[model samples]
Target: LPDVRSQDGFRASLDAIIIMRSNLYTVGRLIEAVMNDNEEEAMDCVKQGADCNQVNKHGAGAIHYVFTDLYLHPPLDLLSKMVANGADVNLRDYEGDTALNLAIKKTSLRPDNTMYKVVDQLMQWGADPTQKDLDGNDALALAENRKYLDIVKLLKKQKTSLIVPPPHETPVPSPRYQKSTTPYESRSPITHSPSPVHPDWGTPVLPAIRSSDPLIAPDREESITSAIEDDNTDELDALLNDPHANLNVPNSMGLFPLHVAILRNNPVSRNDMVQQLLNKGADINVKAIPNEDHDEGGNTPLHMSAARDQLDTVRILLTYDPAISPTNNEGLTPYNYAEQNGNSEMMRLLKEEQRNAERSNKSSTCVIL
Candidate 1:
């Protein structure tokens, strides 16, 4: 080796080595977080430049650990984050099991809907159910061997050839479709209509919203909706910063962007999305007029959050100055919905937030904008 101390390239060389070492350390931290099942730390490591696909001696990647059942329910949210960070879903461990395979295998430890959700998410994320493991059992075969009919049904329903189109294959949809990976998305074809128009579901959720301009185009709107559903803050920020994006008004569903953020059932990202929307000028007290959805009509985001038993969402909403226990068109407040649903946790959260709101109101000057 040459004496590089006197060379012009020495500083660059040292910086490169330091960067490499930092990356390796972050990767190690990611592994440690995975072993401990600390998704927050894992995400921290990912954000700090840890490679999501970095493997251990056993060849298990971060994706594998997210669904591995060493103990407790798997950190499936971490799996989504890992995939979004470019972790390959089909990558195998030493035992030749993909993340989906391991998730399906976990049904032996605890046969529940959690595993099903993981499996379903992995599939939507482009996991090949046909990929087999060492024992020659593919995802479907493993589900069948385990006698988990729901998984079997899910696998059977997914067409092997049609999950995602190849790059060379040109799609034939008229207006082009923007498919969403979230479970709430319907696998429906795109319609050739004006932006944000619903053919089957005629009219806006609220009559007043019918006059509210969509402002954003269909694909842009869908992308934003998908971002909200996934709690993808980076994507959401980009979308919200778009000149055409509108956060305050109701969509065709008679729901504002804030309402969608409130109703998402993800364990993570609920509060994060809410905070992002609020930062982007989302109205905290905007009422959702979900037409004919029973008493869901005239519900503020708080009422919707309480009625849906979204305790964390309610907690986040309360942090912003909002009307406490604001009644809907049904003459029931958020607390009433929580009580009606028998959600004790939600009720407690609403009660505490109401007290906090009261205290806040007593101290702060009420300035109408």
Candidate 2:
């Protein structure tokens, strides 16, 4: 008898056998043999012209089946054999996720060490690190999100250096004020007034003035004090600009200028003056008044703005220093005020600002807007 292994004998044997017309079944059987680690049978079938990269009816190729099974219960040697035998390592399934992507998705299911080995194997077999699936997530970003620090380092090492454009310069606004054609034209050049009283005036008045003696008091004294009390903002602005003026000076009730502004309920002017003072290095954490009312205690400008529903002022204050706590003398925070007042819009704004601060603190994170 002729040798059964000879080409002529093999052809005769094949001819005698009933050949199936279904390529799908043949592909399934090929995958099954490979998955079962029947290396001899798999190699023999492939050499007989079974397509190694053929997809089943579900659009899953040979490599996909290998990857799926490997991640669930990896057979490294068999996977290596399949890779060496020309399995397409980057073939995507119907979901448009490649073998490597699937491997990454399966990483959450495996122990760290095993996942590392699987990732290394995939990378070694030409898995593109930059490839993204239907979800627009690249392997590197996924790795970073998953806290796979070592894998991220490896991917970075393999990646080409990216050429990023230098950051665009933010244009500085012009100093010249654009004149508004409004009915109320600014009466004077935007100039800060001078300090109202001499520094010594606050020390101690002479006994003649201090004594409530009617004979020594001048006729215009009461009118002058009343005028000063009525429109004292210009004087406060002047004092705020004075480098020599005491920042912590209280106007009678032991309230600083900031406290006086708050009590006066002049939020717009108060905010402007407060910002000016802050720009000049005013402390934000100082209590405005030493003793106002035990219950209605002193607060920082942030506390005042939030309690009074001054959203714009609150935003401006936060922009200067978001770390400024919203806590008041009554032990309430800014977030507490927003919540208690049922101001949903203000609450949303404060939360967004908080998130921005958090993002700023995180390394390697980019804010789009």
Candidate 3:
């Protein structure tokens, strides 16, 4: 080691290690590296002083991006590296899901050790399975439901569980949390099912809606529509496990569960409810067919949310990639709804998302070509 080095020389050497970029601390690169599953690049970023726990706008870090559905296994090798470098195992994302919750949700009974291994490794790394998701489902329930017996046994071994935080502690996902579902389809939803009971429209969910029941805790026997409108996240969460629960099925008044949920207004439960509905395959862009209530008819969930000036709800919906310009039967788009309410923020948000959608399309087109 050379002695008597100049202060300026020592400072320059430190800057060189970080690649002296315009942003200086380009931690965003670390997020990108993990998102693409590039272990080599991820390590390089860490070596150059990237914060392994650096979160995106959604409060999700490298660990949060490592999960996929049953068809793909989480990149545990990369996850291990991030955790070793001080990444948080329990950081909640926009969906209020910790890494453990995502792992269980994403895993299935594959031929061999393709997926279950991720769950084991996460548990070993101090992932607390007791941490409940937005809808109050924990890792144990998720694994048990899927019949991943190995994972269930592993969770059962841990005798301790966490008490869910109060509503004040519930994490709210910012607008940047990615919702990536394909926009509205022109086809109708799955209707005419008799086994699942329809909601009671007479018990209005919205303040100005047609029902009389006060928003309360979800009941053991609540219909999907009533559960949604009442912001009964617990009931809605339990119902999602039922293979027969169909959110797309419209009620007698032509209102789908998603339509009711947008107006539910229970801030604590509303976002989680919307997320649950979407995750269980609710159609993001389905329109309400014209009915006796023509004003309620011809509006998409987006239109309803906009008309109600529900900014947080709109942000959550926008993440799922709703069609910004889809016209209702009355030929009004979501933008028109925002405009009529004079919600300048919603209008601005809609415009920005429109630009983002256009850019995303171009990127997809480029990749396809």
Return the top candidate by TM-score: 1
Instruction: In candidate 3, list every pair of residues with a backbone clash.
Output: 203-211, 204-211
Tell me the tens digit of each residue's lDDT in model 1 across 51-154: 87778887887777766666467766676677788888889888889988988777443322355566777888888998888889999898767655446656
Q: Write the per-residue lDDT of candidate 3 for residues 12-120, one digit (tens) a residue.
A: 8888875755223557887787677676887787776677666788677777776743226665666766777787898888778888888777634233233355666
**Per-residue lDDT for 364 in model 1?**
93
lDDT of 2 by residue, 287-334 (tens): 644432222355676665565556667777777764544566677777
Off by over 4 Å in 2: 1-26, 34-49, 69-71, 160-369
All models, RMSD in angstroms: 15.1, 26.9, 21.7
Q: How close is candidate 1 to the true structure, as a TM-score?
A: 0.45
The clash count of every prediction, one per candidate, is: 0, 0, 2
Runs in model 1 deviating more than 4 A are: 1-6, 108-110, 160-170, 174-369
Top lDDT model = 1
What lDDT, from 0 to 1, does candidate 3 have? 0.67
Clashing pairs in 2: none
| Candidate 1 residue pairs in backbone clash | none
